[model samples]
Target: MAKVLSLILGGGKGTRLYPLTQSRSKPAVPFGGKFRLVDIPISNCINSGFRQIYILTQFNSASLHTHINTTYKFDNFSKGFIEILAAEQTFEHDSWYEGTADAVRKNFQHYASLEPDYYLILSGDQLYKMDLESFLDEHIKNGADVSIASTPVTRRAANDLGIVKIDETGKIIEFHEKPGPDKDISDLKIPPSQSDGSDKEYLASMGIYIFNASAMEEGLDNKDSDFGKQIIPSMISTKNVHAYTYKGYWEDIGKISDFFDATLNLATPVPQFNLYDEENPIYTKQRDLPPSKINSCTINSSLATEGSIITDSYISNSVIGIRTIIDSGATLDGVYCMGADRYETLAEKEENRRRGIPNIGIGSGSIIKGAIIDKDVRIGSACRIGVDKMDRKDGSYENYHIIDGIIVIPKKTVIPDGTII
Candidate 1:
């Protein structure tokens, strides 16, 4: 295997996921409860046997930096380590990263010094499992100056991405970045041999590229800062740019809706993307906590991480993070809850309220439905959450009932006991 320098782009602001991305960068946002968004790409690289990696980050990078420092570790004796290349001002440039290509261009000198054979560029916010070795092998075999990972998307969806027109031999001919509705796909005129009958046969770039070191250097030096807007197009006429087709489960969780959907999908019985693939294991910082204890709790197809205590709680179809506690008679359905930070706060409050009682007596008789509760929440007994029809029309009421449903409780809220609906 040749020496490959992998660059994972982790700088995007992720504006669409406003509140979630507000605190952390897009790549650092929590995913599947335990893993961060950046973990997918880094894990893919490690699984693909690439060790020399650099993550380029900029906006709201604190959490991202912490994650990288704690999660990724490489042997010092070996020539492999994951490093963060944060945006810095040099003599020539005082501005922040202007675009994707600009970010790589600024860091070009660093990778150049390493003298790697190939430069692998990846976006950190995508959810996919891939063996990059196969892509690199194909690039070498085709003698490609640049190899772009491409996937076929529906015509309706093609307008949102950079679409490529390739020949039978996979040579990319025409490149369109988010083309308009009227632009005929036939005008690009993909060769008859390469054409599939479906009208939605357009190939979309996965924003992943493998470039010959020299080719990347030259392109970055000669073109405008943006890759999608300029460098990629410049290469089409002069370079041997090929498209490597990918047919698998892949999603770009750039928007809040997409992120929500992706997280929920993991709870499916057989999810589209499997993180537990033995052949290509996605690595993360593993916690050595004990298994979740479910005592008289009804759990249905939910992902529960370590150190969780569910007592008489009905949890179903949700992702529960570590160290979460659900006291007796607490019911939850389709709730994504994290219990790390809130445990201490809730414990302190409970202790104060208990005054040295044997039982802390927090979070009892609480019913939660279709909600996302962050860590460290203490719900006192008889709190009706996520239930409909709290009281009967005749003025009679159940002990726990949710009204208007889908209530999201942020971390560290204290619900007092005997709170009726």
Candidate 2:
């Protein structure tokens, strides 16, 4: 087996998924109820047998650090470790990480110390399942200096992605970044033999790269900061960059709308990104909670985690997280209720009742649709949470917000009774 060091890049400020990223990094943002975005990549690496991992982040990385420290623990006898490399002002560089490539370039010394045969670089916010052993094997078999995992995507989605064009021999020859609709990308489309069925599909980079140790050092020698924007494009003309075609479920949850849709997709009957694959289970910080109790609730097409209670409520097409409580007559549709961080005792519930405040979850008779009720939120009875007029624009309200027609109730918020968005 080749010695591979996995580097999971913690994304930028994540302004696109703001408010959710307000307190945590993009990778630290909670997803699928119990898991964070970082969990996806880390779990992938572990399942792929690459245990020596390093997560690199700079902005608001405390929570990300805590999660990594708490969740991924290995035995001392093994040579495997998962650690964080936060950006710092060192003697060599006084500034923060300017780009993705720069972040790795800055940490080259630590990476070199490992004496790795190959370096596997990945984005922390994507959801996918792939075997890196196969990826690495293909790279070695083809004598590739750099190998990228590319997936075939529709033309509409390809415009936002870094498109890669390969010859009949599967050798990448051209790469273009964020080609607009007006740009001619017909030349970038994949061959018919590689296409599963979609004629409009084009090969797009999955932001996953396997680089030979020396090639990585030489590629980062210049001022190029981003792999998509500079290094990969520049390397194609000089280095042995190849493409590995992958046709599987993959999504980059960068925007609020995309995040909302992707989260709900997991609850589907046949999810594109299966979270319940027994062979490759998605790992996360497990919480010891009791089983969920649904008392006469009309539930359909939903996934409620442990320690949740639904007392005669109506839930459809939603993912209710742990420690959630939905009172009688409450309706949840297309909701992602990331349940409370901790359960309030019976005494605390009594105190809230006397104070005329709802408990730590959705109250009775409330109607929530297309909304993301973040962790530890309290919604009063009869509250209507979806868009008041079905508008697809973004807006803000007190303690809540609407982005791309999806309501984002921030963490630890309290929505009063009969409140409509």
Candidate 3:
């Protein structure tokens, strides 16, 4: 087998996700109730036999570093390892990661010792399951200098992504980055044969690439900082760049709305992104918590993780994360309640009661809908959030925020009694 190294690019300050990204980097944001966003690509790489990996991170990387340290540990027998290459101001490069390609360029010194034959670059904030060994195999078989995994996306979504035009032989002939609706990209639409006879569908780069080491060295020689915007387009003329069409479920969770919808979809009976595949399980920190205990509660199409206590609540189409606690008479719909980090002790609960504050979970008679209640939030009794009003404006409130019409309760927030959002 050929030597290959994987680099997962933890994105820039994830302002799009906002409050969720307030404390942690985008890759460290919790996903599927339990796993973090970075777990997706790491799990994919592990499943695809790419054991040697390095994750590049810059802003708000403390939680990301901690997660990577505790969760992914390889045995002492093999050459398999996963490490973080956090951006640092060294004597040579004195600035942070300016862009995607720049991140790898800055960390070239660390990669040189590995002397990999090929480099697989992936995005840290996407939801997808791919057999990367097969992807690398195809690249080697085609003898291409670069291979980009492209998925067919609708014209509406094409505006926000890097769209490409490929010839019949799958060689990328043209590439456009974030061409807005005003631009005429009809010429870039994929042919009927390539798109399964679909109309107005174009191939969008998934931000997944395989590069020959020499090609990568040459491509990153200049100061072009981003792959989609500058490097790939420039390489199409000088190097052999081809497109590998992937017809699978893939979603980029960049915005609060996307995160909201994607998290809730996991509660569906048949989610587009399957989390129950035994062959390719998404790995994360394994917690030794007891099974969830539900008493007189009604849950429909919901997923509740370990160490949760639900009493007489109504939950529908929601994902209740680990260590969550729902009080009696609480109702939740279309909500992703990121469970607490630790259960409140008896003394702490008593202290909270003495202080007249709500405990570390949903209080009695609270009704929350169409919202994302982040980790360690405390909602007092009779609180109504995202249920009664649709006229809420998009801005930061005293306790929560409304972004893209979705109510976001940031991590460790406290919503008092009779509160309504």
Candidate 4:
């Protein structure tokens, strides 16, 4: 077996995700109910027998560092390990990562020392379950210097992605990045024979790639900052790059609207992305919290994690996370309550009450709909979140702001009594 190093790109500031990425990197952003976005890639690597993994990120990585430290503790006898490579001022490089390719270029020295046969590069913010060993096997079979993981996508979706054209032999011969709708990209559409039964018109790069170690080193020697924008285009003619088709659920939750929709989808009876597949389950920090307690709460199509207490609440189409406490008469719809880091002690709860402060979770009679309540948030009584339902984007209102018509309450914020968004 060839030793492969899996490099996950924990994307930059995640400006599109805004307030959610306000305090954490895109990979560190919470997903589903309990797990962070980083967990998806890490779990996939572990399941695929790729343990020598490295996450590269530069912006707001404090929470990412903490999560990795506290969660991924490898046994002394095991060779499997995951590590973080944050961008720093090294002797060779002074500035931060300009783009994906530049980030890998700066961190090359670290992974190169491992002398892996192949490099498996992945995006950190996508939601998917993949057997990476299969990807590696295809790369070996094709004898490709670079093999990109691709998925069939509709023309509409392909317009926003890096599209590819593969020949009958599955060798990628052409590449186009985010081709404008006005431009003609008929040459980049998937060949009829390879289209199989899928209605998709084009093969879109899933942002996953397998690179021969030497090829990667040579590819990054240029001043190009991004892979899709520069490196891949430059490699198409010189390198034997191939495309491996993937048929599964894959979503890049980069924008706030995408994140919001993806979160709420988990509340459905059968989500597009399943989180309960025991064979390839998503891994995360497992706190020993008791199972959720429902006190006459009416919940429909919702997922409540362990250590939650819902009392007389009507929760529908929501994802309730760990250690979440929803008081009586709270009506929750399309809400994502990312639970607290830890439950406040009795003493701490008493002190808050004495100081007339709201408890560490949702309070009584609160109507929370189309909202995301981040960790350790204190929602006072009768708070009407997403109450305004305005489509216009505006400045923050008491830290409870609207992004693309969804109410986003930043992490650790306090929503006072009778507050309305």
Q: In TM-score terms, which candidate is top? A: 3
TM-scores of the candidates are 0.86, 0.96, 0.99, 0.96
Best by lDDT: 3
Runs of candidate 2 exceeding 4 Å displacement: 350-356, 387-393
Once fitted onto the true fold, the runs of candidate 4 whose alpha carbons sit more than 4 angstroms away are 387-395
lDDT of 3 by residue, 146-186 (tens): 99999998888998999999987888999999998899998
Model 2 worst lDDT window (10 residues): 387-396
Encode model 4's per-residue lDDT on 241-357: one tens digit a residue. 999999999998868889988988988888988887999989999888898999998999999999999999999999998899999999999999998888889999899989988
Worst 10 residues of 3 by lDDT: 191-200
Better candidate number, 3 or 4, judged by lDDT: 3
Error of 2 at 270 (Å): 1.2
Among all windows of ten consecutive residues in candidate 1, which has the lowest summed lDDT?
394-403
At residue 230, give the lDDT of candidate 2: 94
- 258 in model 4: Cα distance from truth in Å? 1.1
Clashes of 2: 0
Model 1: how far is 287 from its true place, Å? 2.6
lDDT measured at residue 263 in model 2 versus the true structure, 0 to 100? 92
Each model's C-alpha lDDT?
Answer: 0.78, 0.89, 0.93, 0.90
Model 3 residue runs over 4 Å out of place are none
